[model samples]
Target: MLFAPLSELYGRTRIYHIANVGFIAFLIGCALAPTLNALIIFRFLSGVFGSCPVTNGGGSISDMIIQQHRGAAMAGFSIGPLLGPIIGPVVGGIVAERLSWRWVFWVLVILSSLLSLVFLAFSRETYAPVLLQRKTDRLRRENINNNINNNAAALLRSKLDAGLTPRELFLRAILRPFKLLVFSPICAICNVFVGIAYGYLYIMFTSITPLFEQQYGFDGVRAGLAFLGLGVGSMLGVAYFSSASDRYIKKKAKEAGDLAADDDDGDGEEGMVRRRPSVGAIKPEYRLPPLRLGAVLLPVGLFIYGWTAQYKVHWIVPIIGTTIMGSLQLYLVDTFTIYAASALAANSVVRSLLGAVLPLAGGPMYEKLGLGWGNSLLAFIAVALIPVPWLFMRYGEFLRKRFAIENL
Candidate 1:
């Protein structure tokens, strides 16, 4: 939350660098801490600072890329984080087995430090507001240097006068996410759906170990191998979404063009009126198609996975179910998050919050219900909410109109 506001207030590059440094420092502290309390405190602090990337990543996407091309960028961005858990255990196990647990923190610090340097060196300021402010300053300085005491200079100065003060932008940036949560029904609803999906994913992450070990009599390495199915499925899912997303948008645009041609009169103005419903202006709801598909796949996959495991069916059967569920989970997470950002300004705070809270509920939930009934319970709730994306897709414009939130 703190990082989100700061990134918006200033710019992404600076926040990225600052956060990265703080994150690395905390990692070092975690590695060197003599006491568990110190390690725990440092770990908590590291998480707080480490969140800057995800919080600011969407804004950077908006700044640096056109909407049509963002699918690929978002897909690439989504892959790294989504794959971490699947890969983390595999590596962490080896590292912990071979070296002390402190080595885990030390190794991460080393790798992250190198990555942070690359990011700091390569990344430029991409936030539009920040870029514009810099441009305005440059123009003003150049004008003064040239002694261009004319209407142009006066106009530029007036524009600068009307622009937001640093204090004002800071306040707005900090408050915008909260405002959306309170005032925007779409944001609130979407956040809930995404959070549930995320929580369920984390639940699987925690429960998979015990499920394989106790239920299937699998050892540490084989149990770890179970996550490989999810990793492969998630990669395939990303491939599906990334490969088709841009094409889908273009196809919709082409169809919209055809419809506009049919509605065209002698003049372009009337045609534009008719074209409003078409892809001349792509709506945020375009991001939801994958989400709509995900709603169906998520529950069905969960049911199959859970029941198949419960019944001690062929091991491959449950694995296949997880593969499907894992793939769909990635698609849903990416889509819901991107859609939410599109629907509400500075709403990445909601994503950050969702990411943080979802995993915490998984362990207890699995403990109580066990793998079969626990996942089934989740599937039931998920199935019940399947209509959510559809409803938003169909009536989104109407809801947006009625709610009438400004600058959304």
Candidate 2:
């Protein structure tokens, strides 16, 4: 959460590169740990450093891409993170079996370091304020010895900003996400719904192995391969939402006419869309459609997966359910992310906390209720959450106005 705000002040590329380097160093520490305690500590530290991208990557996308194209860009950005787990276990099993457990960390270190270095070398500054600050500095330096008139100098200086004191800006940056969660009903409500969805995803991740192992009598490699079905579904979801979200936003903005005008100035401002009434106006509600689709799919997919697996039907049957769930989850997550880019740290923390806590209950739930009832409990939760997005879609603007959520 803290890192998300810093990215705005310092620029995304710099913060990302620094965080990546920290992640690499921590991975190395994990690889060379002297004891189990050391390894666990290092692992936790590494996750902290690794969170920078998850927290700020959306803001960076908003900085660089226009609203119309942002969905596709975000979809492309999300693929690697979402797909990594599905692919990792397949390769990890081989590495742990053929080499050693330590080599897994070493492999991640090498891959991560290479990617981080590539990004550091190639990525440009995307934060608008930082870019404008740099521009202002250069202009000040270049015109130091010029014979420009007083009016021209005053005009140039007027273009420079003097908005916030350093301390005030820092305080706002750190506290804004939390403030949004507390004050903005939309943010709070969406956080709960999406947080549960994210948590369910983690529970599914842990359950996949046991589901395949006990039910199908699969070995390690085969059990790991089961995740591929979910992976394929996630990719398909990404492909669909990548284009569909943008198209939906455009269509809705066009229909709403002036009512949906974007709050962003045409200048390069972080998290702000450029004004182009000709193309269409933009509104926060435009993000709710994909979320609605997800709300429906979540329960349907869970029920299907639970019942089919309980009946010991064909493995393909369960995979079909997983694909539906996975795709819908991706769409919903991506939509929430783009919609609330500025509050990403709070959103991410909520999701991560739910992800950790929910899985602890999954095993017991399944054990006590059996597969059918265990998953039905989750489906019930999803069903109850369906109204959340709908309410937000219908009355989000009213709530924003009522609460006075400025610049949202």
Candidate 3:
């Protein structure tokens, strides 16, 4: 949320540069911290800084690519974060075993520093508002010396005046995601599924260590290799579905015709039909098919993992199940990123708030219910919510029309 808003307010290039620098600093701090508390604080700060890519990646794709091409672009971005959770622990296990846990932070510092430098050297601004603002600023400056018509200057001055104060903008940014959560049924349902998937992931992460050690009798390093299944699954899912999302959207837009307007943009005119395909023709349903497939597979994977683990099935069985779960989970994350961005374009702040808070509830949910039933319970809940995407796909136009969110 902060990154997106900042990208709009300032510029994507500047915020990207600033965020990378801050990420490097926080990573170094994490490496240097003597106490666990300091390490936690630094990690949180690092997350705040690191969130730049996650938040802005969607908007960046939206800005740079036309709607027809955004799915593949988004899919490419999804690969990194989806694979991180799986890969991080595996790498950390090796580093900690060879050196100490502190080396985990040190390793991250070195890696993040290198990436930061690379980004600093190559990244460019992509947000349209920021780009336009820069153009406006440059034009105004050039026109200032001439006694020529100051139309651009007047426009810039008006824009600056019409802009919300920092406080109001900040509040709007923060609350918009939440408003989407409360009001948008599509967002609310997706949040529940996404939140559960996240919680299940962490629970699996925490529980796998013990399960592998106790039941399979593997050491930390060997046990951590099990995560490879999830990593591989996630990678494959992103490769497969990310492109699928874009294709699906394009296909739907063609079928729905050019009259389909986005709820986020209020430019649909019944008679303004164009024979050619355009970004405006795309609908939110393009984002849903992948999510629907994910929703179905997610629960089935959980049920398999839970029951198989409960019965002391072969390690490979649970691992296979987990791989499936991981793939579905990553797909959910990718879909939600696009969904939230599309559903609440101007109110991304609220989406970020939901993103942050929803996962907090997952830890406790798993703790009270052991792996099998805990996941099963989640699966059942997911099943209940499966109708959401379908509802939105069939009737979303009416809902958008009724609520007039297109105008908001």
State which candidate has the highest lDDT: 2
The order by descending TM-score is 2, 1, 3
TM-scores of the models, in the given order? 0.87, 0.89, 0.85
Ranking by lDDT: 2, 1, 3
Tens-place lDDT per residue, model 3, 65-132, is 87677767877787787678778878989999999988897888888788878887888887655566
lDDT of 3 at 354: 45
Local distance difference test, each candidate: 0.74, 0.81, 0.71
Encode model 2's per-residue lDDT on 173-279: one tens digit a residue: 78877788888877777777778987887788888889988998888778788888779878988988987899998787666654445665567554554344553
Per-residue lDDT of 137 in model 3: 66
Q: Give the least accurate 10-residue stretch of model 3, judged by summed lDDT.
A: 343-352
Q: lDDT of candidate 3 vs native?
A: 0.71
lDDT winner between candidates 2 and 3: 2
Please give the distance, in angstroms, between residue 6's alpha carbon in candidate 2 and its true position after superposition: 1.7
Candidate 1 achieves a global lDDT of 0.74
**Which residue pairs of candidate 3 clash?**
173-349, 176-350, 177-349, 177-350, 177-351, 178-350
User: After superposing candidate 3, which stretches have Cα over 4 Å from the reference?
Assistant: 143-149, 153-168, 256-274, 340-370, 406-408
Give the least accurate 10-residue stretch of model 1, judged by summed lDDT: 271-280
